[model samples]
Target chain A: MELLDFARGPALQFALAVFVLGFLWRIVSLFLMPRTKDRSAARPGTRPALFAATREIIRRTAPDKAFGKHSLFALVNGYVFHVGLFIVIIGFAPHIVFFRDLLGVAWPSLPNNVIYAAGVITIASMMVALVRRFLNPVQRLISTLDDYFSWLVTFLPVLTGLLANSHLWVRYETLLAIHILSVELFLIWLPFGKLMHLALVFVTRSQIGTHLAHRGAQI
Target chain B: MTREINVQAAANRFLAQISGNLGAYMEACLHCGHCADACHFYAVTDDPRYTPAYKLFPMARTYKRSKPPLSWFGGAPKVTEKDLQEWEELLFDSCTMCGRCTMVCPMGIDIASIVAASRQAFVAAGLGPPDLLQAAENARDKGSPLGVSADVLADRVEWLADDNEVDIPLDKEKADVLLTVSSIELMKYPDSLVAMAKLLNHAGIDWTLSSKGYEATNFGFLSGRSDIAKIMIQRIVDAAESVGAKTVVIPECGHAYGVLRWAGANILGKPLPFEVVHITEFLADLKRRGKLKLKPMGDAVTYHDPCQISRRGGATQAARDLLDGFATDFREMTPTGNHNWCCGGGGGVQAMSRAAGLRHKVFKLKMDQVEQTGADTMLSACANCRLTMDESKEHWHWDKDLGSLVEVLAEHIDESNAAA
Candidate 1:
């Protein structure tokens, strides 16, 4: 089969299967692991523990005042990249068509210019994150090979998608094929690397809130 | 590697101690390094190793190696002796397990809890700090970490009872409150005990000090030994039950209150038959009930909320209410309440002599916070915080009066109702 056909057929299928099954396995393992029961007395007259957990999952998305100043770069760049990626993935016209084809659901797409702008911002923010990881000594110290590898995989999909959309330096079909392949690579890597954070973030944040609220401290 | 290290055993111990949420925390960390800014040690020393996330690296490494998808790839780097040696200082001496990092983590990772799980592995591997281990042993065998015998505690109680002209009941059966104190309160800050005695007496509360469980500080909890912590907690439970007390009042030691108030149920494997309260909370409850009255202290004072008492024990409002009732000029420190920085002496770091320098170094953040409050006298309910602040005061020759909240309340007690 031609590279484009293989990329769209087998590569896409394999990536989706791995993505779905890998996430299921990881999530199931998390639930299967023994949970330490919190035997501490619940605070009286307080909201239920799950309420605090849900509250934190929402509350932590914004920069907390306690560490806002220190986390400005991380908060800004992180939000920009994540929101941009979300728009590019779900709001772009072609991606919406692709999703509709796959899942039989249709949604209104944003303007091409808006999606393009989001792609550009996402690419720029990923670059900033990359540079910060290399430049900041503490960040560099904590970073592992997997961190850099994940960054590369995460960054390439947006970069290639934007390039494909722009039809720059390559045929549109070829660029599109490369973009899909890059996205497939990212999907394959998602469950194994730090990108697993996409799912675990909700789980951990609520867990932290539940534990803290059980002790009667609002997170 | 000539040294034989049971990395697998240590890994199992760590996994056993942690929960599923911990797995999520490990997986969710982005290595954003925001937690570094939250740690006082890293803030003061500018050491990357002291970063909260860095402190969790060893456990994260082990988790990745032993657990699923990553484990298929030869796992993470093995837990080596060098890692253990390095992490011993990072986990115990530098980090106070203050939970500040946990609060500030954008990913909502409980960094302190992860460090605590690491400490459990260290303890299981016989790698816990010697001083903390020794203190835990002392508390296990001698009933007091400071080695103050029961007779010594009884004598101090007698002396305080005679000095205050009130009967300090010891092991009194069927009391309303079973008041337990730390060794620091009994030894270094006897005046706090005196203050508590006066207030309890003046309020006409049926409270008694138990000789069997007088020491509230649990070195096992500090040392990360569940067995030792359980033993220490069970002693207090037994003492409280034997006295048939409705409430067990933990004195002004921060971790002491945390051990009994929070961890007591877990250690005892059931709900405590009696209520556990901090001295500040008890006093505040009395005032709220109009059972105890206090004259207003006109001095400008700021209250330091000990991390454990306010953040962990949920007694922040109680302390504030009590302080507001008595101190007409009560000033709040910036970033007060649950977000207050630790006094750099908790988690048994105060007992470890080797950690003194690091503790004092990290104490600069707290010192600056207190200085900004501009209150000459800073009152704290935790005896450990008070002692650490006093040490910092002497080290820097800081011209500030560090007083206990209970003691200050005792000095301003309203004696008009004594005649009744």
Candidate 2:
């Protein structure tokens, strides 16, 4: 088979299977872990624990006032890259075509320029983030090899996809093939590395949210 | 490595108790460094190692190795003796387990809880602070970390009653309220215990001081020994049960409220039969119910939230409501309530004599917090907080008056309506 066909077919299939199974395995392991019971007398909260957990997922998108000033760069930069990736992935017409062909469904795509702008912004934001990690003393100290590797895999697909669309790379087919391969790499890495935070962040936020809300503090 | 204890066994023991959100929190961390600034130690010292997430290294490292799939990669770093040596200070001396980092993290990792878990592993490895460990031993053996025994509490109560001319009941067979004082109150601040008596008497509540479990403070909880925490809390539980007390009013001790109200049942693997409340919460309820007629004061006052009481304990408004009830000019610290900065001396840090310099150093930030509030009197519902802040105040020679909330509130209880 041609490289493009192999990249878009067997590689995609294998990566998805690994991603799905690994993701589920990791989640199951989390559930398997014993949970600390709050056997203390509880105060009635205005909202139920479940609702509070759901609320905290959105509430923590911004930092609390005391620490907000310090988190400004992280806040804006994080949102920019994440929203940018979402737009580039699902809001672009070609990406939507790939999605519809896979899932048998598609949403409305943004204009080409908008998608291009999002792609550029995502790339820039990611680079700035990586630089921040490289430079900031705290980030530099805490970041592990997994953090840098995850960033590379995540950034490659966006960069390759944008180059393929712009036809600025070696050839359209090769660029698209490389883009698909990069996405596969990201999928394989997602369930194992810190990128697994995609699923676990909600789990963590919800768990703590419930724990605190049950005790009468608003998350 | 310590020769007497097997380090790997301690790691295994700690890994065995990985409960609740431990797995998820370990998986969710991005090492984004957001938790760094959220920590008071890092906030004050600007030290990268003092970052909250870094403190979880030992536990996180061991946890990865304990799990098969993650360890199979051969990439999970081994915990070194050298790493443990540095972490001993990082986990015990610096971080207060205040939960501010937990609150501020975008991923919702319980950074403070995980830090406490790391301390458990260290303590198991025979690496805990000697001061805190000794205090826990005293708490387990003597019924009070400060060695304030039952006879000491009874004699002190008697002396305070005669000195203040107040009705102080002790060891009643049955009472609706069981007033438990911290060792700090019994050993050092007997007047606060007197204040407790005055408030309970003014409310006409059926309250009694149990000689069996008078010390509310639990050093075992601070030292990361859940077994000792259970034993310490069980004394109070048994005392409450024997006395037939419906409510155990935890004195102005933050960690006491934590280990008793929150961790009591979890450590014991059973729910406590009676209610556990902080003195501030009980006082606030009394104020709400018009049980105590407190005369309003004009002095400018603010409250220092003990980490365990306000943020981790979730009784954010109890002290504020009590203060607002009686103070006409009650000022607030920036980021008050659950978001308030931890007084530098919590989480057994105050008990560890070696941590005094760092404790006093970071206390400058807390002093700045109080000074900015422009308050003459800063009251704390947690004696652990008041004790440390008072010491730090002496170090800095800070001019403001620091008082326990219940003690200050005692002065405001209207004498005309007080029960004879």
Give lDDT tens digits, candidate 1, residues A124-198: 899999998888878989999889999999999998988888889799889988999999999998998889888
Give lDDT tens digits, candidate 1, residues B1-420: 243456666778998865677788887888898888877887888888887899888889988887888899777888887788778888888777788887778778877778767888888876877888999988888888888778988889889889877678898877989999889888899888889988998888999988878889998988888788988888888888898888999999889888788878877889888888889988898898887788889898888888888876777898898977578888898778988878888888888888888778866776788788778888999898888878877888878789999999989888986523
User: If scored against the real structure, what TM-score would every candidate get?
Assistant: 0.97, 0.97
DockQ scores for all predicted structures: 0.72, 0.73
Superposed model 1: Cα runs more than 4 Å off: B1-8, B418-420
State the lDDT of candidate 2 residue by residue for A1-219, as single tens digits.
Answer: 988999989999999998999889888887887777778777754577779889999888777665645667977899899999988988989888988998999889999999999999999999999999989899899888888999999999999998998999598999999999999999998888888888888898898888788777774
Please report the interface RMSD of model 2 to 1 decimal. Answer: 1.5
Q: Model 2: which docking level applies? A: medium
Highest DockQ scorer: 2
TM-score of chain B of each: 0.96, 0.97
Q: What's model 2's lDDT at B197?
A: 89
TM-score of chain A of 1: 0.96
